[model samples]
Target: MGQVDPHRPPWVFDCKLTARTTPNPEKFDEALRQHVGRPGHWIDLEVRGDCSDAELELIRRLAQEADTRPVVVRHVAKLISAGQEEAGHDEPS
Candidate 1:
């Protein structure tokens, strides 16, 4: 959590790291698609801080135009807070 920066979107708290991988544009999209399709439940794609303009655009597409394969999605950005960050937890600056 941004204990030092209050203006940070509350959406920051609700994020869950569903995957980690090398920087490959195709794989980023592919992995997110697969993850949201997992059989356990419906997953809303929540996005926060982006490292680049490309990434911002990518998230925009996913949260807007991403209806490719295995799922039909017309996403709406609904912010849900997971409250505060736990001890020893940190988000990249």
Candidate 2:
């Protein structure tokens, strides 16, 4: 896990990512609930391996509705791989 800079504000929003094959509307609502009055809160997606297009769309919508900045979906894959490497997993050639 990456260390948080103490100088930065603590995160306020946390949303677990839905499976690529399944999307839970209830979860979306729950995540949005955290957005109330916390526009500066960082939304963290708990992706299980990979995130689906639908999941990304839902996150984008939520971000827009919550008046938060949109995140770049492209970096998710790289970040995941980096995390795996940090955990001592060897990448296949």
8-72 in candidate 1: lDDT tens per residue? 65446655544343356574456665545545444455443324557655565663444433333
**Which numbered prediction scores highest in TM-score against the true structure?**
2
The C-alpha local distance difference test score for the whole of candidate 1 amounts to 0.48
Measure candidate 2: CA RMSD: 11.2
- RMSD to native, candidate 1: 11.8
TM-score of candidate 2 on Cα atoms, chains taken together:
0.31
What's model 1's TM-score? 0.29
TM-score of each: 0.29, 0.31
Clashing pairs in 2: none
RMSD of each: 11.8, 11.2
